[model samples]
Target: MGHRARSRTRRNCPSLQEQLVHTTFLEELVFWTVKFEFPQKMVCLLLIMLPDTDYKEALTQAFVLHYSRISMMLERSTDPDTLSNRVVHVSVQLFSNESLAFRMAENLNLLHVMVISLKYMMGKILIQNTLHDADKNFHYVVDCGRQVMKEHCYWPLVSDLNNVLSHRPVAVKFMSDDNLLEMWFTFLAMFQGMNVNQREMTQHVEYEPNTYYAAFSAELEASAYPMWALVSHLIDSSSIDLTKRVLTSCLIALQDWLDAINFTHPHMNDSMQVSFHLPLHRYFSVFMCQAIKHQGLSLQEILPPRDVLTLIMMHPLRVQCFHWFPTFILTITITIISSHLISSHRDMERMSGVTWATISLTPLGISDEFMQPGQRMRD
Candidate 1:
């Protein structure tokens, strides 16, 4: 009787590989499982019971599976857009579980794989956008351009990454320790073509916001939104040291962007010039205001916003930008100046500096009331 019971117990247990495969399968079941409360609870229970090593294995395999699909799609051998999208869709679902997010990001190898994939996809996008076809109809071409920007693999992936980090403080801390923040900053700077010295005259535009030039610029701005969103998450951290570091890196990135713009703007036509109204530029003031209020940290402790503003204004590109991007620069300049003023306000100690600055800047003078509690930015 004892021997028979032992044999049955052994048969009931799954092997390690089976467990890993089951973990991966759960990602696929998210949609169906989420529709019914009991199934979702069961899936969550299984996730909780899974060992760390098996979860990591599942994650690695998931990345490999999606990357392979993406490669095939790019090759035009087979269009597996659905398969590729599962990568992001599954990731977002997985990140909805904080424990899973922690496990996903805690592995340094996983972080590298994720970031490298992001960079690869973005590089492909930049290459595709740089080579425009002039033969296509203007409206049709603009629509196509916008579609590519929206449909590209990088778009959803970066958006998911931003969303994940926004809520997952543990994951953010892990990523920051791995220098993911700096990597993102550097990538954004290059993605803007700030590092490329050569500039070519683009096909000219007849009017603003209606031409291919406008579409192209809008695509650039849209692509940059995630990076600034990540910055917002970082500055919102509780650690003064981390906030200080983020502010400094923010300044460095802006200076690099300014220098590159100054160098390239002169050679480009009005239609092709990079706009200063990108998310990174617009959000810098908010970041500064948040940092100033972080744990009562001083402006001097964080990099001075005035210094960044001075750099932007003093750059030779500024005069040309004022001519071409007046509304863009003026809007951001006012926000930054307002933030600078709010930082010095004695009431800042009593009220949230970010709320104060935001209310003052808004047209109707309404303020965002929700202030998330801060978390440690790093280990």
Candidate 2:
């Protein structure tokens, strides 16, 4: 009976070992299958997210799916404050799709107002960059900054503007000019009645070091057209000596700004680099044309009709260099001729009354002969 029991135990052990080996083989196969499938899944996800086909609905669906998973994770977190802060961060991360992020942010009151203010501030900046009205843009940015201060007691708004002034000295120079004087006055008025540095203005996050600096850098580097226009004006209006001094300083500042914007270390990819030379040249050309028109004592002497024609002829070679060159040449020619014709009443009246008839109607006209292909062949 004992021998029979031992034999039965041995038989059971062999069957158990065989079953374990089969389970281990199945586990290895599952692992390999998952590993092979994940990259393909990611590729499909990227293809679905591609913007070329206007798959906004699909993108929104994907965003919803991602946010649902995030919501579940947030629910599982132990600390409520950590979850609140994370919600704020998630809301901000969603800002790439601003409309959706804003919808999410609207429901979350647990986060500090500072984060909301930053979102609004970023939106204002985006609008200002695209908007046509400078005054309106300024008002919007300043108002958002003021609101941030009022709601969150963040004086970094002032600091942000100050840092922008320092880095883009042109903004300050232009802001001091007559055109922007009213806006500056308005800004001063808004801040005057309140405490400049009221720490307890509202209970909010403490000031982060370099907050203003980072903000200014991001704003300036993102768009430097305002700064460029301001510097160009200074260069145009100043006296010769003053112009040279200002230009030298402006160029140095501009170079620094350009480097800051466009600098790409080896770690950065090609798309990360910025190139502003095309825009700079276009603006500078316009500035030069305006300056010449206003300051030149004798337009006829400076650019005669023949000179204008020559300039127009040279244009074809440099077509890629300037878009407005032909238009400007035409305007300059017309201006010079008008100035000449206006000086003499007799010449003006003689040229004005009779429109010249096209010579194509005449038998000897070359244009008519060229139009008649048979005649051209005979000739």
Candidate 3:
């Protein structure tokens, strides 16, 4: 009787083990399917299960997952235009949820990345959406812009402006006031940071003469576009404080460039060589001239045409073989004096001689026409 009972117990134990194995396999399959189907729910569940300190990594992972999913959607969609517009829609919906903001603020670095990604995605969306239906799409863009500024203070949002400026299509027009202000402050912060970093780098170079000026020049040149955009916006908005800051930064940057130029080629120390300087100098000069003009300054007020020409001629690194400064100075000076001659006949004669003297003093030799005293009387 004891042997029979033991045999029966062993047979029932195998059946019980089979049942347990089958139940475990089914449970595993169900869990994976549920995880695949409801990722956000799973994330929320995990967040609830884990301690608060562990939420940062989970939040970052979730943000990255969303970004990946959006990217995949953008790639797979047949209609990029519609998909781009939808990106803003999705961002707006997420932003409206207060809980997301709280979660984002918990991890500032992740928050920065998320905001940058959203701004970039939204900017692209506005551009694409406005391509066909500019009026309607622009209204939507303005709304989004306002929402962004309202939700995220303008100053904090500035951290992402450089990326937006670099990535957005240059041709896209900004119509919203909020967009304009956001851009303005962002640009301000970007240049401000760049200026700080550049100064630090420049200080390092003071002891290292072997450091190539070209390397520093390249770094300065990289910031030109963003600087121009900032200055241009300040000019457009007529923001005096912002404009002053831009001018101050510009002067600092210009002084640095001048130092680099002088360091690289000490021979061309004269101001006249400014015109004959490298292509970058010419580009920067042109931008400066335009910026001055936009600010309503006459050419003479900033610096006489002759002086500008002289600076160009004296620039040591003449990329061009011919010294065009003399001709350029003479032409511009003549035009100015001619325009002035009509307004004030008496002042013209005296002004022409003074201008001629200025040009001659510049690194360039004066033309025979200007040198001949009697000739100046008629022309």
Model 3: how far residue 185 lies from native, Å: 19
Give candidates' CA RMSD values in order.
15.4, 29.9, 24.1
Give the lowest summed-lDDT range of ten residues in model 2: 190-199
Deviation (Å) of 184 in candidate 3: 17
TM-score of 1: 0.53
TM-score of each model, in listed order: 0.53, 0.19, 0.28
Ordered from best to worst lDDT, the candidate numbers read: 1, 3, 2
Residue 27 miss distance in model 2 (angstroms)? 60
Q: Model 2 residue 137 lDDT? A: 24
lDDT of 2 by residue, 120-193 (tens): 34343222211122242232222223323223222232222232333323333433333132222222222211
Over all chains combined, what TM-score does candidate 3 have?
Answer: 0.28
Better of 2 and 3 by TM-score: 3
**Candidate 1, overall lDDT?**
0.42
> Would you list the C-alpha lDDT of every candidate in the order shown?
0.42, 0.30, 0.33
Clashes per candidate (backbone, < 3 Å): 0, 0, 16
Best by lDDT: 1
Tens-digit per-residue lDDT, 24-95, candidate 1: 474554323332322435445545634576664564345433432333243232323543354455455555
Q: Write the per-residue lDDT of candidate 3 for residues 216-277, one digit (tens) a residue.
A: 23223323433444445534324434433433343344344333233332233122112211
